[model samples]
Target: MNTSLKALAVFIALAGSAWAEDLQDLPDDTLLGEVVTATENGEEERLLDLMREVQARGLLMFPKPQTCTFSYPDTEFFGNEIFRGAVRWGFGTDLRELAMSQGFCGCIYDLGSLDAFTQERIGKPAQDATTSDFSVFRKYRRSDWSDVNERYQNFQLERCGS
Candidate 1:
């Protein structure tokens, strides 16, 4: 099989597993509907509190940016780190939105995008950190960042049904 076919196989396997897993512990559709109703009813505080509560409960998670190490000596830089970008999202881009805009219906929400949306709804900017001085996930290693990001995506699925 070609590389694209191999990737498709992996995607199928992951999707199948995600579907096969018993998510009985997660909120049902009715609960998710209530949350959506809160969004429409302007219960910002309740929504925010719910978001935080779920995160605290391990049902929601945060996604830190991944980075790679770089080495340079001529410029007096040694083993500095740089962001490597998420699986499909760029530093500030919304991967799920991009995919949906391209007409994909089965894609789940990207945690970065979901977090940014929630923050923006609460009148704060997205994590929006940059390397101009320091990064928000400055203390996080690449592996940790990726793990949290994947969990965050799962949280979106669990809480928001995306």
Candidate 2:
């Protein structure tokens, strides 16, 4: 009986060590973070971390303005320069709300920033606020307003209970 108990204990110890070794060999993604510490350039790491969090939370997106002068270049509806600036500098959430409420265009602000620039721009978890899922609304638009509007409208309808 004593010899058998010793053998059992030895087997348990070996199994435990093997399990620990397997855990150590697991990938970084299996952990909570990317673990880019070895290449830690502070600025780059900070930016990458923010980007990772944004992607992880799925908030790195935004829609386009519905009534963009870009589509009707000849028509100056809201003072071409003013309209452009408004799109550039205006709060993304406000723009999204305006599009859904008034225009054909739809907007979604997905950029993750904890600092509140405007009431609408308070970036938080998507589960916290439905609108925080920018990817659900529109992708990061560079130019095509029409595509952005279409995507946003679909997203709003799907996610925001439109």
Candidate number of the best lDDT: 1
Q: Please provide, for model 2 over 34-74, each residue's C-alpha lDDT reduced to its tens digit, 9 standing for 90 to 100.
A: 23321233436444554454343333245233433222123
User: TM-score winner among the candidates?
Assistant: 1
Local accuracy by lDDT, each model: 0.41, 0.39
lDDT of residue 98 for candidate 1:
43
User: Which ranges in model 2 have alpha carbons more than 4 Å from their true place?
Assistant: 1-86, 89-142
Model 1, 46-116: lDDT tens digits are: 55654543443333233344332222222211123343232123332344334333322232443234345
TM-score of 2: 0.21
Worst 10 residues of 2 by lDDT: 30-39
Per-residue error for 24 in candidate 2, Å, reads 35
Q: Please report how far candidate 1 places residue 14 from its true position, in Å.
A: 39
